[model samples]
Target: MNPEIIGQYLPLYGEAAILTVELGFLGVLFSAVVGLFCAAVLYLRVPILRQIVWIYIELSRNTPLLIQLFFIYYGLPKVGIRTTPAVCGVAGLTFLGGSYMAEAFRSGLEAVPKIQEESALSLGMTKAQAIRLVILPQAFSVSVPALVANVIFLLKETSVFSAVSLMDLMFTAKNLIGLYYDTTEALFLLVVFYLIILLPVGVLGTVLEKRVRYAGFGS
Candidate 1:
């Protein structure tokens, strides 16, 4: 490993890593919003809407993200639903993350005490009011760690965005190798980059998990 190669390749890899984080951060933010809404829908047991939410979750969760990305980038545009590569990457990742997160949030909602809802109803709250006030807060409190972990997973999964020309870290690393031809060094740096990005996330998730558990709404 020449320090000279590091000087050249590292900058490209760093840029790539930044792009990767940017893409994932946007996608995860969207997913968190979508997932929470969908989970709330299912939790509230809306007559027809919960079924639709279930279908959405199942379809996205069952399919591989690669195929999802392909369809978004290639398949949809054939029918005129065109978007830029970056937009497509973000959409695909958000859909993908949203599905998985719906399940997590749903599971957390299940852990809430049954009496909580009953008590809310007795207090003359509407279903929406009860859920918004009573259930969701508790559910979200229980699932913070899972949400954080999934965010980290989504962060790593953004590497797939390179295939769509999103120029994320993995894509940047490959480009770096093409320029520098130092496979060992470039690939090694790729691994190190992810470690740097994800380790702190993982540690933070664990700490948050401990806090949630100790706070008594936990598993």
Candidate 2:
């Protein structure tokens, strides 16, 4: 709590916060790409792909992320796969967020009226054309809020990277505490770091939700 110690520590904490922001940004993007594709498989009623998507979702959604990260860090090498801790952290966050977000997309897809599909069919639109032109726009509009929430969750989930020895904000905080031997100041600074990393995502989510509501969805 000493002003001098905090003054000395501020620069390091700032750098660590930047790293945490990068991790959250990358993790959310990875999850959205993977989750949207998988969710589309189920929504489109792709025969074998639907089954595979379900299996993937169930396996990932049911497992704890810490265990998943451990497996990625430890078990991957045993099975002849190797990736850096940062890579594994991204993969872990992607799988964790993708499973949950896919379900949200699936639900949103179901919310879009089937009449729209029939209308497109009567106009001789191909399946892909109908889905792309008529369906996904509405589906995504409906799902935007949920997607934002999932992104926020993904951001928080990146904390697991610290457990695997990644030098994210949290890992830096732990090191600072150990090096400085001041638990209260180190932890207070870390909490500030987390808030700086995470609060904007919350504000962004609210803005996105408002945008979605104004888009003629949930009317």
Candidate number achieving the greatest lDDT relative to the actual structure = 1
Model 1, span 25-85: residue lDDT tens: 8899899889988987887788899999989998998898889999999999889899999
Relative to the unseen true structure, what is the C-alpha lDDT of residue 168 in candidate 2, on a scale of 0 to 100?
A: 78
TM-score of every candidate: 0.91, 0.92
Worst 10 residues of 1 by lDDT: 210-219
In candidate 1, stretches whose alpha carbon ends up further than 4 angstroms from where it belongs are 124-126, 214-219
Question: Which residue pairs of candidate 1 clash?
Answer: none
lDDT of 1 at 170: 85
lDDT of each: 0.85, 0.82
The residue-by-residue lDDT of candidate 2 on 76-187, one tens digit each, is: 9999999898788888888888888898788778888888888998999998899899888778778888887787777777767888898877787789888878778778
- Using TM-score as the measure, the top candidate is 2
Residue 90 CA error for candidate 1 (Å)?
A: 0.6
Off by over 4 Å in 2: 214-219
